[model samples]
Target chain A: MPTMFEKIWNRHRVLEREDGQTLLYVDRHLLHDGTAPAFEMLRARGAKLRAPDRAFATPDHYMPTDTRRVAEIANPELREMVASLTRNAAQEGFTLFGLDDARQGIVHVVGPEQGISQPGMLIVCGDSHTSTHGALGALAFGIGMTEVAHVLATQCLWQRKPRAMRITLEGRLGPGVTAKDMILHIIARIGTAGATGHVIEYAGPAVRALSMEARLTLCNMSIEAGARAGMVAPDETTFAYLQGRPYAPADWDRAVEGWRALRSDDDAVFDAEVTLDAAEIAPTVTWGTSPQEAIAVDGLVPDPAAEPDAARRAELTAMLDYMALHPGQALEGLAVDRVFIGSCTNGRLEDLRAAAAIAQGRRVADGLRAWVVPGSAPVKRAAEEEGLHRIFLDAGFEWREAGCSMCLGTNGEIGAPGERIAATSNRNFRGRQGPGVRTHLMSPAMAAAAAVTGRITDIRTL
Target chain B: MERFRPVRSIAVPFARDNIDTDQILPARFLHLPRDADHGACLFRDLRGAPDFPLDRPQWQGARIALGGRNFACGSSRENAVWAMHGHGFRAVIAPSFGDIFAQNGLKNGLLPVRLPEATVAAMIARAEAEPSAELTVDLQAQQVIDADGVAHPFEIDPFARRCLLEGIDELAFTLSHEEEIAAFERRIGRENS
Candidate 1:
């Protein structure tokens, strides 16, 4: 009754120390601007990359998303930083998706889209959202810069095995609730640090029923819950998603056979298990700084004094203060100044489609700036081909190229001070959108609904 | 690569919970060179307030920071730790820390001391009461010495403790096993061949 995580982990183990640490071979290393330091460290040390073939590079985090020329990078230091990444990737012989490359996008999004993230693989990235690749049945997680350099110098990393936790999503989702909502609801049920020191494998009828993009979205935010990683077992759905992608194995049938074998035993046991009824979940929104400070659209902002734990109550008080929210106030119709429908968490094609479906033949509310950024260049091309871009543009939303824009305020995309934004991004941390900018995390469709109404509104009602 | 040694320094208390990396060193300032003076940017949004501990004259040149639970609780950006280090902080005492932040802190030679919530709260209260009071964190003995001469024992992973005391950076330690790693790779390569 071994869990799928254990099975994959056991296969990748190279050496085990007496202290219970294992040296596991990493199959792929996804790199982006956040990891430029690793290359700099390697260069400073005069060390050569040990396994360049296993590494992939891109600069999604630092690049301007609006087709600004590289020379127009206003900050000279940032321009140098982006240029050094391209130069280092070329010198190191790692496959790179520079800004001009058609394949350029967020590393987490591009990896799965290009089939570089596959089942039974051990993937690591410098970015915390690396857990998104686990939807393909891979054991993936974010590593710090030290680990990134270690992986670059050696295709292996030292890891203490994490305890297994199973989060089962039972039954079908209710109407208008999405994978984003389900994850938000889960984080709310379990506080931000609830899943610390564990690797979670999401299972059950509801999880298996989700599309590949939705499953990726579910795993993407696992870090927010403090889990080292989150994964879904590969099935026919996973195989079909990987079949024709650029980097998929040429021997497709054989690859599927191997992937078919990747599953937990029928009676697999976990150290902890939590079950959620999909029908109970709603279109969720965060009311406070942390992702866990969330509630359903119809729910009220929590009163901190009612909280039993003094520490949590204090945290809640701080969140309520920073978010400028009052106790017992209804969350619906809270005015928003901006709406961002992008991020590795919700910038995939399906995510854009959900937003476009709500935006089609509608106009954005006056004084609200709504922007739609596709997850990858391919996702951008596909959305344009299907006129999803036209729908968003027609609705008065700014349709932009692919990059991690506004999800983080770096790269010249920041909200003004005190501006409140309805965001489809993963984090709702205080000032995450911009300094003094309040963020309400929601699904893309919900963000779209808010964009059209200029306030937080339930997509179901719309 | 400086080896951690015993230090007794005044502790500046900032008791905010879940002070995420965004607040530690906002993404806007991360574009500056790593060696750029991030001390000015540390808590840039909250620094100017007279009530803020770091802005107070009594806490100037303090080498310790006391905070509430889940300190440094967001992104794996090492800049948060670097900024604190740049501000001359050697240790951050908290009830808890984000896992990634703790790891990054250890890598950067900054100590992230985890203590029980009440104990940390008491320490913070003491620091606030006596701004000139010094706390001595003994890495070798694994204890935090408070103003009342009480020693609070803290636990650390044995391996991490060794790394800090010996100044053994991750790269040097990882490269030490190069032969073993190369041999293992060769063995696997042969099997595939």
Candidate 2:
């Protein structure tokens, strides 16, 4: 009766303390530019990486999307962060995807693309979006800098086993409703803390029907819902995606044999179970600062006065004020100042294709700033080969290089203060893109639709 | 890491839910060194505004914070914990927290206490109404004593509680078990082969 999570947890268990905290052996440790502090900790402790071969490093968070030259990063401090990762990787023996490398991208996108993340592996990174790797059926989660140091020193982490939750999506999703919309809908229904202290296993027909890229997008935002991790059991679709990737197991048949057994038992019990109708999901967008304040594209912004709880009413009022949104304001036709279509959450090749399809014959609204930054250099190259860049460029959307551009605005890629943005990345927190910047999170197609109309227009209507 | 001792100090109430790490320490300041004074960056953007809670004279130098549900929700940046600890907050009382942030807090000797929603709300109200109200949090006893002298019990992982109480360095402790870790690795290597 063990679920997929239990199976992976058991396999990784090295030892359990009397208080029930288990030391789980990590199979893969991904690092990014922000990991300089962890390396510094290792230096301070006079320690060396226990398993260098199991770790990989890349520079993304601080990378400039406009240039490949590290010196062109502008800020000396940010340049050092990117350079430190390269320096640390050379000092310690581990693979480093440097700025000019075609393989360099957001760590989440690069992991799946390179096949470093596999079914049943215990993968970890210092970034919260590490949950994105669970799309490959791995027990992946994010860690802090201290935990990153622990993993670097010992290749293990102490974790209290989180309870298992299964979220089942039934029926086929309606056209124009993507995985981004589905996850946003789920977070809105259950609230941000709905899955706290639990790892979510997505199952049922709709989950199985998603492409690997779509599944990655869905799992990428699991952290946004307060879930420790999110997973979809490996199946034919997963096998097909990883078949010829760089790091796929050499003994393909044997690996597939083991992966086929990675699902939960038919009668397995879960700590909690939730079901969502996929057909009911629509192209959704956040109306407030928090991700939980999402509604259907056709819906109006909610009025805070209608909320009964005093605290909740206050929160809604504050969020509305920060977003510059009015009570009961129509989400559609709300003018947007910027449109960003990239990030680990929605910067995959398929995501770019979705956006390109919407931008094929349409021109971006006059005076609107729109950009399509590919998730990785490989994604950029592939999109260029397919003429997707030409389509975006023809439609007046700036075609930029890879890296996490405008997602967290850490790379000097932020909208102006008080600019309302239609973003395909995760998180709509206050001042996330920039100080006083109002962000509306949505799917790539919806973001593209907004770019064309210069407002928050529903993709279906476009 | 310093040993987590009992803290009795005036509490600051944020009176908001889902206050994310970005608000605690903006992404722009993430590249700063760990030793930098992060206290100055705490709620940097939100501060200086009219009636910002952290800027209020009564809440200055508070060592404890009372917040609503899902406090420190987004991002896995441990710097958020550092910002709070650097700002003289020894303990935070909330109904829930982001998993990564809570773990980061324990490793840094900043105690994260989970109390009932209503109980926390009452404490927040009390702290806000009475600026001089002080709350005591005793890790060893696993209880929070409010200004009214009512002790509300809370639960934390036993292992985490012990580590915080003794100020144990987790990396050092893990490294001490090197032999067993190697043995376990060999066994897994054999099993996979």
The candidate scoring highest on TM-score is 2
Chain A TM-score, cand. 1:
0.98
lDDT of 1 by residue, A1-462 (tens): 888999999988887765577889998999987777787777778888999988988788877777746898887766776798888887999999888888889899999999999999999998788999999999999887877888898788888898999999999899999999999999899878778778889999999999999999999999888888999999989988988899998878877887888898889889999999998999999999889988999999989889998767877887788788898889998999999999999999999999999999899999999999888898999999999999999999999888888998777788998899999999887778888899999999999999999999988888
DockQ, candidate no. 2: 0.83
Candidate 1 clashing pairs, residues 3+ apart or interchain: none
Candidate 2, residues B1-193: lDDT per residue as tens digits? 8889899999999878888999999999998999999989999999997857898999888999998899999899999999999999989999999899999999998899999999999988998799899999999999999888999999998988988999888888789889889998999889778
| Top candidate when judged by DockQ against the true structure | 2
- Candidates' lDDT values, in order? 0.88, 0.93
lDDT of 1 at A311: 67
lDDT of 2 by residue, A1-462 (tens): 899999999999888888889999999999999999999999999999999999988888998899999988889998999999999999999998888687999999999999999999999999999999999999999999999999999999999999999999999899999999999999998889999889999998999999999999999999999999999999999999999999999989999999999899998899999999999999999999989999999999989889998878888888899998899999999999999999999999999999999999999999999999999989999999999999999999999988898999888889899999999999999999999999999999999999999999988878
